[model samples]
Target chain A: MKEAAGRRRQSAAASPCAACKLLRRRCVQGCVFAPHFPAEEPRKFACVHKVFGASNVSKLLQEMAEQHRGDAVRSLVFEADARVRDPVYGCVALISSLHRQIQSLQAQLALSQAHILHLRMRRTAAAHLASGDHITSASASSLSLEVDQTARFY
Target chain B: MKEAAGRRRQSAAASPCAACKLLRRRCVQGCVFAPHFPAEEPRKFACVHKVFGASNVSKLLQEMAEQHRGDAVRSLVFEADARVRDPVYGCVALISSLHRQIQSLQAQLALSQAHILHLRMRRTAAAHLASGDHITSASASSLSLEVDQTARFY
Candidate 1:
């Protein structure tokens, strides 16, 4: 136990976390930022520190539980990066853009469905005429509604 | 100018911002939390403070531009609320859920288009047969490929 603790302390003294390195501070053992912001990924901490100050992030991490801090830090880094890129909208802009795509796709799907129904109705009418049976377009349409099964979109 | 400043000072004194109210701290004239976390919406600041800490959030807002601080706070509040609900995933869960919906919708759309093409081909073959034309199903299918235009999914 003493050997492990001494090694951990030596490791902290040798290479600090990105947050501590950039902030020019000592990264002691059990650093809150050490697990999430490794020394190698300096850019992650840089952007996050630029958007939300290093001190603030450190404080926030310290407040969170050890298990939850990693995920919380990830979320903060993502939001901070987005904020740095877009001063106003940030990640909300991506959500809105996706919403627009969904709306456009839904409209297209509805139109395709309507056109498919039209084609089916015309085919049903032609089938009736080809079988030597006389039927109005209205009856053919009813027959289509009765026989056509809803498609399972795979 | 002095009158306006006085009134603004009086306003600040009359109603401290939600963050100040909850933290039991003094809200000064240039309190960064006032505009975003209005008195009526104390819950916004409550969640944000709980997640990100009051001091950290205040410092972050102060660093941001006056015009942008409102949007930034809104984004923070939204993420904070999501984090409170789902401690690990936060708003990222919402983004992932939206992505899944988009993929499912795209699959449904492709299936619908394929079904439409099949229906159009069958109808074309039947039409050829009913018009006193003797053509094999193969030729009728080729005719379908030639005559069937792409449906405008609008």
Candidate 2:
């Protein structure tokens, strides 16, 4: 046990994972976060620690699948960075601003669609008027025939 | 001048407008906020004044048209209330949360639309197959007539 503790101390001094380093804990072999969060980028874990705290992060990582851990860590880091920068709203502010943009876009889209529908209706009405004028101009002898044709067309 | 001063003193003593009272200023006859922000509802102006400051609110009301002032004041009061509750995020947090809801709703709407389109396409395909079976069962003697009818229908 003493030899194992000495070896762990040597390993911890050499290269502790960011999470362990930030929390000032000894990083054991096959640590859960070691693969995803390396010892090189200390700031990543710092941000996450500040926002979510180390214990909650540990529980979260433990609950998640191994394959999904990397993505989860990435999301946490991003959210933490946002939280550090904007303590009040964090990522929520960005989402809100984006939502406002989408609303304005939707309104514009509705207006444009209405305008297109109006134009199509006007075009159809004009075409009908023009066809009616042609029928009116036709000989009186063919008036009944023209009317039947117009009725069929409609 | 003395008479005018006495009259002003009498009016000021009667009941100062909320904005002037909160800001510790004399409410003159032509005070801009007097008509909208009465002394009775001092809390409304208090919240607005705390969040936006009396000077900024005054400037904003002065710049806007009379028709828009009511809406501006309402918005200010609401924002101020939110700010008092959450000094960090304030109104921005509400905006951000609302934005998230909008995004989720939009995603749901898009998914529903896509599902509808998929269902419509499947129904159309099924209808086409059913019509094809009918065409195949029709008598061979009426094949040309059927073809002509189908062409016209198309």
Candidate 3:
């Protein structure tokens, strides 16, 4: 027990990487996650581990090539952050909320466009009536008025 | 070989639930998914299975309460539809697109409100300048003009 305690103290003195330290695991030499996830930002790994279990993350990192691991880690971190913030839906909620907003905005855009078109048509008709011009042969003044009104956006 | 063929025919005659059929598994007695997903709507299960794999969905269904299962299935279908439409981001893309739209709409709303406020303030300042009226002693007629302009919203 005394010898084991002494070895543990020595290992502690060496200072494990942030992930292993937070996870309370021994950071062995050639730890795959250490280089990408440093000791300073334990929260990054904490959120990732919380959402996608540490083992799964380990498996994913192990499966990917060295060149791709960095990007994979970044994507995982972003998704994990979204997941942690909204537990039930995680990133999905963000996506759904955004979808709803798009629907509403699209509706609003349609309405605004329709209103603009209606206003333009009404102005054209009124110009024709005021000038007493026929349907096919609208006066140049009425045409110019139509252009001016349509061009005047708000 | 004849006996195996007979057994396969027997199983096929039973007609598995949509979920089981899509997954190419036998729909045994008391399948949790059977009641919610009938055999007729194979496409429903196909989309759901395509977006969220069978095992994860099964696990999720198993974890939820019996009462909540129906609604959960419905939401899953909606999300799966969105996912299938946008494979790369799945539902996340819909959310992101909506979020971007919401941001833009919110910005537009703010601008419109600001413009209305600025217009009101200018009108008020002009009225004050024209009539030499004190801030608190403004007439009801001036306020009525503000209301009329705002009410003229198309």
Best by lDDT: 1
Per-residue C-alpha lDDT of model 2 across residues B44-69, encoded as one tens digit per residue: 98876654457656766776677877
Q: What is the DockQ of each candidate?
A: 0.31, 0.03, 0.18
Q: Rate the local accuracy (lDDT) of all candidates.
A: 0.76, 0.65, 0.67
lDDT, candidate 3, A71-94, per-residue tens: 667766766687567434556656
Could you tell me the TM-score of candidate 2?
A: 0.41
How many residue pairs clash (N, CA or C atoms closer than 3 angstroms) in each of the candidate models, in the order given?
0, 0, 4
Poorest 10 consecutive residues by lDDT, candidate 3 chain B: B86-95
Error of 1 at A39 (Å): 1.3
Q: Candidate 1: where is the Cα deviation over 4 Å? A: A1-13, A50-72, A132-154, B1-13, B53-69, B131-154
lDDT of 1 at B50: 70
Native contact share for candidate 3 = 0.18
Q: What is the TM-score of chain A alone in each candidate?
A: 0.71, 0.74, 0.68
**Which candidate gets the maximum DockQ versus the true structure?**
1
Candidate 1's DockQ is: 0.31
Better of 1 and 2 by lDDT: 1
What is the full ranking by lDDT, best candidate first? Answer: 1, 3, 2
Fnat across every predicted model, in order: 0.40, 0.02, 0.18
Clashes in model 1: which pairs?
none
